[model samples]
Target chain A: MLEIKEIWKTFNAGTVNEKQALRGVSLTLNEGDFCTVIGGNGAGKSTMLNAVAGTWAVDQGTISIGGTDVTHLPEHKRAAFIGRVFQDPMMGTAPTMQIIENLALAARRGQRRGLRWGLAKAEKDRYQELLSGLGLGLEDRLTSKVGLLSGGQRQALTLLMASLKKPKLLLLDEHTAALDPKTAAKVLELSDKIVAENHLTTMMVTHNMKDAIQHGNRLIMMYDGRIVIDVSGEEKKKLTVPQLLELFSKVSGSDEADDKLLLS
Target chain B: MTVFLNALPGAVSQGLVWGIMAIGVYLTYKILDIADLTVDGSFCTGGAVFVMLFAGGANVWTAMLAALLAGMLAGLVSGLLNAACGIPAILCGILTQLGLYSVNMAIMDFKASVAINVTQADTLEKLLVSLRFVQGSVKGDFPLWRHPILVVGLFTACLIGVLYAFFGTELGSALRATGSNGNMARAQGINTDFCKVLGLMLSNGLVALSGALLCQYNGANEINVGRGAIVIGLAAVIIGDVLFSKLFRNFALKLLAVVIGAIIYYIVLQAVLAMGLNPNYLKLLSALVVAVFLSLPYWKGRYFAKPVKRGGAANA
Candidate 1:
């Protein structure tokens, strides 16, 4: 469903603060695959997802979504086939806009916008039905400005918006990191339900080891701008934190996994 | 008291004319989330276009339309500088405004000022608005259309109505979304650059129209007519926002608040003049008022803020 070929991105190149975010990283996802990505800080997991999302032009790479190369497309143009939920809750939606309006915007994702009315009477009813599915009571507040919503509600709304038009690839960038535990669990569950129902190809970045292991059909660990270990299906189901650490230590040729990775 | 009363009608009419320009500022400042200084020049460009075209024996409406288009062209330059050339929005507007001084001069036949030939044999009957008509209407000898308050008031209402509807449409919503959140708008494939450019065009078009009307009312277009125009517009917007934000919940009513704010501003200016203040100091007074109003919200949030109490008293 998505392909990344030897992508490379360097920030502040030729400067004192130069840092290479991605280096010759390549990965491909099969159709209907829900992949969970994990890494320590600066592991390039998020950078890899951004590369595929076309947040900026990678110094070197070719990325394709559903067999169409989109590496050269600008961020907004590439949005035609990509759905993104950012790490910051505020980045995913317009705060000053209303719930129905936000959904209506997402409904036109990948489509040309014209002089038609932004919100049709029928669209409100449909958004209400979709919001009720989240069980957040959002349907009751369709016209309320999105800024008034709690973080979880907003993320859930963002999730709904991202999947409104069924993009070819959905990118979730630590979407639940800022939420309270209960709310994070609720949002994660909502993400799972939406992706499953839509049969969407998804790449979800997470900080929690348990979550990375528990959700998704496959899991990949990134370290120093490269994928160190990838486990899937039967192997992924049997994987435990300690075993995963041992595998990471072996594959990364490191003495041991860092405490931050274990603790997180 | 007599001086103040005598200035009231003139203040109201001037306020109504400036109110239109303030509405244009509201689009960029409040809607597009930009403070476009381009109006400082485009306002004069509007007057220059109107006066120059009307003097060339064109129809009055044609002159007005040309003025609107000229203002929009000025906006297009600023918008491209900001969006396409990668300059900051404020800087882009400043650049366009600076360049427009020369452009406006050229448009006015390289003259620093120009006037409508109302005294000419063929001109006075074609004027859409004028101070003479305003005086005639006050004496109850002219038609209702000749009243500045009525003519400009009706025009403002129509402009507001059209804006209110336009903002509710898909393209308009995309523009609003772009202003509110560019990142999210792009994620939705909104082509926000196009929206920004279009918004500037729409905003400056209205500003030029306001300028055209002001020129007609004053019977002259001076190069300095647009001086401090941005401050006045910002003052109107901030005043309207501070005063009527809570009372006016509807979009159209909010726009009306801006117009009312301009009227209040002009009425206050009239009072200051009645009190014997120098006319040249009026711009200084407007700047101070805007500065104070702009800082009010920040001051309230910082100085008078209540502590955020937690659920438990101990947590507070």
Candidate 2:
């Protein structure tokens, strides 16, 4: 359950480098909705996610999650209701910290940190169980610094951390874009399983059209600064690559989608 | 050899005193991932606050507490400048350190330096630890607990124990996370600004306490006492990290290593002085030693270590 209304953001206004990143964009996601967002280069897809995450305040418009307006809330304050995974795996976890410590931090999201011991014994057991569920053998090395983990491992760990506290809205900004196809697929599968199991409302951005189509219940295509195509239910399942491109051409009237949009 | 032997006790006691300050340095330099320059000013602020308070008839304990508070306030200013005003951490600390020079002078009643009336009945009897006690404990003029080494060693142990416990707490972990990865900390809903401020406060509090002890031991608080203090602090932290980082993985032991590093640093200084090195070159020597140690890891990794392919899912 998340809502965005009339969001507009322009970077470096009235200068040579000025670019309108987001222009009057609005979208709403119902509970348990898993939406895959697809767009070519500079489609404002990631910008939309960052806006919801409150990385920077939008020049105009409001965003609300679970019936609370977070338009003016700082990024960290907005973190109370949102879980985020960045494109860079390094961005989601402290590399020098232990795996269990990272999970422990996630577990206490939206809660005040007091003088209590950081990681409880019971939490360690629970974290091991969670790690085992990933089937990555991370349960055996809970104390190892996250810096030693491979990027894929870090990404998987970040995915687990994001949903550890069951955020009201999960935001994935090209979360698996950097991984190899096999690892990306595995991570995507894990994402689906985790989101489905938790009934999490999620918005995932991907450049690959197939992932945009093959995953999630709803699909939206962005061109320029606005969502131009919205498909879901039977229609979303029936959509294909050429058909989606045709719709993008019909709406945005730009053929810039040829190379950047992955047909496979 | 005789000169070295005669100075060993004083050197050891002075080392123990500075070890507490090194622990304070470690909090910012290692834990918070900040090379805070504010300690240079706050160190004297502690001595100035303590000496002025003690001279005005306050008990040593109360004066020490006041000094600790003064140091925390200095850290608070630096933290606000860095975190709130968006100044860089180094610049914020430098500004605070520069401003504190005048503040330290004012605290000494516009004098560049001040002394404890060690001859006065109140100042002498109310004192906690002093350099005189270093030889006094040997002659049984005072109890062993009054010895500078013993008193400061106990003080260092207590500081380390409290820091070890504090860092094990949830709030402390949050602060560590903030320094480790700000993005992750914020995503975890940690108020990173608050954590940075709290850490600076904690760090400067210890630094000031060390300064209070230093002034008491030396019998005077001078304006230049804290000059280049950051270099010494860095020397202790880097030395400990270089020598004991692998052997001392536990947090408490790492702190102990830092104190041990300070002792070793002072012993070397004393040895160099005894070996006919000009005393004025000590700061330069300290800076060079720290610089070399700081670059050792980087140079080893950059020039000697093998590069590996990064980012494979199979590696997971």
Candidate 3:
């Protein structure tokens, strides 16, 4: 459902800080494919996802969602076909806005906002039902500001918002990294449930190798600026942390793996 | 004390007139989370547009509408500079404000100021609100209903009512979201740049409306009328937020708080002057007061923040 062709992005192009963030990287995901991405720091994992999200114009690339070329589309325009959950919990929702208001905003994605009342009476019941499904009791606090919710709750809410309208693609950029283990596990489980329920095409960036193996129908490992390992279906299901580290060591030509990636 | 009492009605009327401008400032400052310095020049743009059009024999409403449109244009320039050109927000506002000086001068035919000949009966009768109405009402020359206080009070109420409704709309909610979280807004498919421009237009439009009213009230539009206007706007918004944020939880009430804040600001100014302070030092005093109030929240965060054990699934 999503197509990316040989994308290249360089930061600070000519200056001393110049770094090629993405170098001829390319990938394609089929409809209903939930892909987990793993990479060490500066692996260009987030950079690749950002390239697909149109955070900035790629130096050279072509991206298409559902056969529509959106290579030059601005971030907000690309939003019509994409849902994104940022790493920072605060980045995914407006703190001062109410719970229902944030949901309403997500529900109206790809639609023109007009002079009509922001929260429709008919949608309130639907949102309440959806919130209740999360088991967070957010249904009772429709008018409460999202800022009052805890990190996990906010992350859960953001997950709901991202999949609210079932976009062509959903991008999760290490969404639960900030939370404690238990909460992160809960949010990850929630992500699985939501993706299955919605049959969403999702790309989830994760630091945990075990998680990269455990979840998703497909898994891809990024190293240095390109995808060096791609595993799917039965192969992905049988993948283990040790095997993945072995693959990484083989691909990176190093005896020592990235400490942060291994520890996480 | 008696002198202060005698000036109280005029002070209140002036406050009500400025209260409209404060509401405009509230839109950008509070709602949009932008300190748009465009008001410094747009205020006079409104006055200049209104007075020139009114002098040219346009209806008062038409003149006011022109003034509002002029102000919106000024806001558009600043919005484009900031959003499209990617200039810093403060710098964009400053650039627009600086450019507006010449625009205001040109609007007044290169003159520094323009005065309405209120001595003429037609002109006097045509004005919506004026200082003469304030004094005349006190001496019973005009009815209380015709007083500038009553006239401008109605204007403020209607303005707040309109704003309250607008902010509740889908477009308005998106605008608020843009201010609250631009990244979130964009992810949700909101054109945040468009929202920012619309907000600036709306904000400067109201500011111009207030300026036009001020010109009518004072019987003149001076080039320096808008000098320090942003400070006063900020003063009113901060004062309102400090005093009434807790008491007024509703959107409409928050706007009313801003108006009342302006009134309180004017009342305090009158009291200080009554105590023999020189009028020449008024701007300096206003600057200091606003500076202190602006620093208050930062001080609280830096000096008084409590350490809290934060994070985890338990809180969630």
Candidate 4:
């Protein structure tokens, strides 16, 4: 469950580079709701996800997750309730660290790290089991440096890490955008399986319209820093590319969809 | 050649003493990914604190402990400036290092140097390690166990063992994660700022401990004793990494390589001095050596790197 109320964020205010990234945006997601977000460049889709993640304080409005206000909380503090997978595969895992070490870090999310040995003998079996489930054969490379993994593998590991502690909400910001078509599809499929298995409430920002349609229970399209189109339940299940494009044209008052939105 | 051979023991002993400081630099430089300039000041701060307390009748261990604490305090200031005040990491270290000059001077009663009255038999007898220990052991006047090389070698071993264990702990792993990927660390709920500060404290504490030992060994703590200390520390770390990174994959062995690197650095310096190099140019030579070694990786990547063929023919 997540609540965001009229959040406003502006970057570089009073400067020539000023841009309004978010404009009085509000959205709510019920428990176990997986929301797919779609928008062209500079449409604030990623900005909205970042606001919920508390990457920075919004200029106005409040946000809460699982019934607790996190508007004033810092990014790391808010991490207790949120799992994040970044657009860049390198951003989500420590490259110089080992695979198991990264997983161990994720296991202790929201908990104080003390002087105990980082990897307990008992937890190794559990980690190997989880890695095997990824079907990437990472279980055999527990001590291998994560830097050596492929981009798709790293993204998959990041997804596992994000869901390791079962946060209240998982945020995926174009997590597969950097991978090749085959790898991207694989990672997306992995994301769906993981989210479904965990019953995780998720907000996934994607540029691909087909992916936007093919995944998640609810769909929202952002335009000009605001949510221009939102459809859910039976309405979303029956939606197609043409209908979504027509709705975007109606709400955005544009004869054609943005080239990126249409083409991507 | 005979002179160089005769100087081997002293060079090795001095190298072992400085190896401790190099280990401290390794923690911040390699582990925390910070180039903390504070060690240049904190090194003298340790020596100053040790000499003042020891001359004032404190026990040897108490004085050394005070030295380590003084160094840790210096690191804390730099850490707070960088982490809490959000000053740039390099600037924070520079500020703390500059401030520590005045503090070190005051600790030594505004003197340019402080001596431990090593001419006094009681003072000489009380020192844990000294230049005299090397000669006295060689001459069989003192027990071989009292040799500076042996004592300092044991110190380095213990330090490496402790660091290896600490780095394997949960808190240490978090610190490693902070250095390797700060964004990932924060998302995993690690307090990265806290880890950075803690690392600086631990690093400077060891540096100061080395400085205290050096002051005892040299018979005096000079105001300029710590000048170019960071360069020496960097030289040791870079040299060790270049030469032994492949061979020493284990954490404890890696630390051992750093100490060995320091020893090798001193031995080379001794050899150059034996070949009639002017002592005044020593710092310049050290600077150039470190600068060259530091640029090797960049040059290798920029100029010597070859095009790679991936999963196909070379032309393809």
Candidate 5:
């Protein structure tokens, strides 16, 4: 479970370009809760995830994961309990490393790194099995450089790596946005499967209204750095894109829907 | 031809020393994606520390260890300046280099320079003399080519071997990942700041080790020995990577290529000198070599299209 209390974040504060990215945004997720966050541009969706991930210290408030106060922990320290995937496919994995090597790093997260031979035989076999489950043929290419992988394959591997140890919270920041629609669907399906199998407490942010509505058990709409609507269970299941857009228009007091968000 | 062949071993010996420095440069520039200028000063710092320690009656091995430690300290300072203080890596290197100017002077006992007396019965010469049979078989009154070239070459080979083994380890893989993608490495719980510090320490330590070896081999430690070292190291790494593209994918082979690259670079310079070229143009030659080799990958990617493709496009 994760708890965020009155988290506030601002960029370039006290400058001409000052922007209040997150304005007293507060939300909580219970264990095994799979939440999809829908927002238009600058809705603090990514900022909220980053604030939890400890990418930067929030201007105000506390973040707790599994009852541990991680508000003051730095990014690397918080990494022991939190796993994150970024918007860019390239941002989630080391391109130059072999697939198995990258998995070994993920597997060994928070362990003391030493001058030992990399990836034991049993570990390699385990990684192969995991990769095979992705159905991406990556099991056969364990030794190939990850840079050569397609965007979908890389994102899938990143998702697997992020959840390899089943951290307390999993943060997905528009992880499939850069992929083709077909690939995106596959990745989303894979994401659902992984989250279900692991029973992961997940927060996935997306701009696509349909995806936001269809995938997760709980769906939340964010506007101006605040959660405007939080719907779940059968309520979330029956929600439509048009109804969600109408809700957003009513709450945010904006008649104009972002074209990109609507089109996507 | 005989003279060149006679100098071959010496060139190789010097090349191995430079190779070590080139590998150090590679760690920062290639592996860590950081442009570090600390190498020039660190190389001299290593030499100066070794010479000063040796002058103070330390054993050769102890002196070398001291030099390595000193270099690690210098690297740590640079890393701290970069990671802790939020200074850019290049600026950190420059600051360290400037600070080393005084530190190096102090290491030389405030003397402008220090000359290790080869005539003195040093451990290296004593070890060589003790192997009379090996020396006598090759040339009477000779000591099995126990010059700096042989010692430095053998030492470099061992160093490269150890580095190769280290880079193949799990920790090394993590460090490499840190270089390739800092954010992802962090997300995996890798302490990238610590990795950066450790990497720079290893890099500058190797550079300094090369410097110490050069001092012992050349029988002198000059304040200016580290001058132009960064350029030379860059030249060797680029040349090596260009010549050994296939080999460089492996960490060990990449290290070896850097050593070979340094030797080849020197051999070409020697050849040009032999052709009556002015020695003053050596810096220009070094620059041109680096530039040409660095551009090679781009040129191949951009201009080396197949004739079939060209013809097919024309027909279309």
Candidate 6:
């Protein structure tokens, strides 16, 4: 479960190019909740996820993850409770390292790193089993450098790495945006399967309105640094893109959606 | 042929020292993905610190340790500049290097140059003189060589072995990952800033250790000893990468290749000099060599690989 209280974040505060990324935004997620977030460009969706991840200090806010106050924690310190898959596939994994090594790193997350030999037999077997679950045949290529993998495969590997330690919260920030349509569909399916099987509390941000409706138990829409709509349970399951669009237009008081978000 | 053989031992010995420095450079440049120029300053810092400590009655081991610590401090300064002040990594390195010049001078007892007089008291010199005396009494008129290159060569070999083992460890793997992708490392709960500082410190410490040994071997330490050292180290790394592409997967082999590359570089320089080349043009020659090696990767990637842009034709 996660709670964000009165979060406010401003970039380049008081400067000529100042932008208030998040303004008095607050949200909550119960245990095992999978929430899909939809927003236009600069809607603070990514900023909200980053705030949860502690990418930077919020100007004012209190964030609690599973009853632990983590708003003041540094990015690395908060990483034990937060697993993040970035928009860029390259941003989530080390390219030069082998697949098994990357998994080994993820498995040791939050533990004291030492000078011992990496990837003992048990760890390697555990990683192979986990990779096999992705159905990507990465289990057979434990020694293959991650750079040699396709974008989808790399993203899948990154997903596995992020979830290996079973963090308290998983953050997926447009994780499938960089992949081809088919690959994206496959990855999205895998994301659902993984989150469901692991009983993870996840926040997935996507520009696609259909995806927002099609997945997750809860759906939220944001505009101008605030959550405009939060739908869940029966209402979220029955929602359609048209209905969501109509709600966005009515709530934001704008018939015209941002071109980027609409086109995307 | 005999001249080449006679030069081989010295070349190999010096190459090992340069190899250590090159590997140090590779740590920051290739692994950490930062263009760290602190090596240039730390190398001289090492030499100055070593000589000063040794002259102040410290043993060789103690002097070497001092040099390593001094180099680490130099690297820490660079890391702090980049992290605390938001300066660019390269500029941070340059600032630290510039600051180290004065610090190194101060460390050398405010001297511009300090020459370790190896005429009599040096361990190697004493051993060599004793051997020569024995040879003189027995063989009479047989030439005797001073300063056994074998000891230095063995020491360097052991150092490389230790480094190879260390780099294969989990901590080393994490350090390497930090260089490959800092953000990913951080997302995985690795404190990348700490890793950067640790990597830079380790890198410059090794470089300074080499410089310390180099000064003792050469019998003198000048303020400018580290000038253009970064380029030389880069040249070694690039050349080593080119010649031993197959060995790149192994850290130790890559390091060994760097040692060979340095020796080959020196041999080429010596050969050019033997062919009546100007010794003063060493820097220019080094730059050209580095340029050629650096461009090889791009050249191969562009021309020799399958053409991605043009239909299915192989570009080469």
Scored against the true structure, residue A71 in model 1 reaches a CA lDDT of 90
Give the Cα error of residue B302 in candidate 5, in Å: 4.3
Interface Cα RMSD per model, in Å? 2.2, 1.0, 1.0, 2.2, 3.5, 3.0
**Of models 5 and 6, which has the larger TM-score?**
5
Q: In model 6, which residue pairs have backbone atoms overlapping below 3 Å?
A: none
* Model 2: lDDT of residue B179: 89
Model 5 chain B worst lDDT run, 10 consecutive residues: B126-135
lDDT (Cα, tens digit) per residue for candidate 3, span A109-135 = 989999999888999999999999998
**Whose lDDT is greatest here?**
4
Error of 6 at A255 (Å): 0.4
TM-score per model for chain B alone? 0.96, 0.95, 0.96, 0.97, 0.88, 0.87
The parts of candidate 4 lying over 4 Å away from their true place are B310-316
- Looking only at chain B, model 4 earns a TM-score of 0.97
Give the clashing pairs for model 2: none
By lDDT, the better pick of 2 and 6 is: 2
Error of 2 at A259 (Å): 2.1
TM-score of chain A of each: 0.98, 0.98, 0.98, 0.98, 0.97, 0.97
lDDT of every model, 2 decimals: 0.91, 0.91, 0.93, 0.93, 0.85, 0.84
Q: Tell me, by DockQ, which candidate is best.
A: 3
Tens-digit lDDT string for candidate 6 (B127-151): 2122223234335443433332444
Report how far off residue B149 is in candidate 2 (Å).
Answer: 1.4
Q: All candidates' TM-scores?
A: 0.97, 0.97, 0.98, 0.98, 0.94, 0.93
Query: What residue pairs clash in candidate 3, if any at all?
Result: none
State the lDDT at A172 in candidate 6.
98
**Which portions of model 6 show Cα errors greater than 4 Å?**
A258-260, B1-5, B121-149, B300-305, B309-316
- Of candidate 1 chain A, the 10-residue stretch with the lowest lDDT total is A255-264
Q: For model 5, what is the alpha-carbon lDDT of residue A44? A: 85
Per-model tally of clashing residue pairs? 0, 0, 0, 0, 0, 0
